[model samples]
Target: VYVETGTGELVPASLQRAQPALLEIPASLDAYLKSIGDKSRNMIRKARKLGYEFRRLTPEMLGQDIYEIRTSDPMRQGRPIP
Candidate 1:
């Protein structure tokens, strides 16, 4: 079953849980390829060549980077950002 936000479609019974929820992906073997910059993609390829499997951090971690960047802006701190 699949679900998406920002749409008014009815939920499928098969996907319905006993509690409120958001959609989630269980896992994927190629998870490391998602949400990556070009440098990280190259690093992943190198690691795989060396018999290492890279794991991508969750989008929540990416959100943390955005949040930190926003909060740390010099203009946001009430002074001219030099």
Candidate 2:
């Protein structure tokens, strides 16, 4: 058996097939949050209350952080790096 999946409905039509799903990209973060609704908002708020935070990495920290995460167990298990 074989299976394939990807974005863009037009690509499948070129091959005489139809994609099972359509992708939608939100215009902004606010649009994304509104689409997911209140439950997700509450969960994010609770996580923040518990001291979790998210932000972009500083240039000085980027290399070390990327190397650490790429070598970590979770990333290795998901897909081994050559």
Error of 1 at 63 (Å): 34
CA lDDT, every prediction? 0.70, 0.75
Minimal lDDT window, size 10, model 1? 8-17
Against the true structure, candidate 2 has what lDDT?
0.75
Over 8-66, each residue of candidate 2 has an lDDT whose tens digit, in order, gives 33332244366668779999978888999699999988999999999887867788887
Estimate the TM-score of every prediction: 0.26, 0.41
After superposition on all CA atoms, how large is the RMSD of candidate 2? 8.4
Q: Which stretches of candidate 1 lie over 4 Å from their true place?
A: 1-34, 54-82
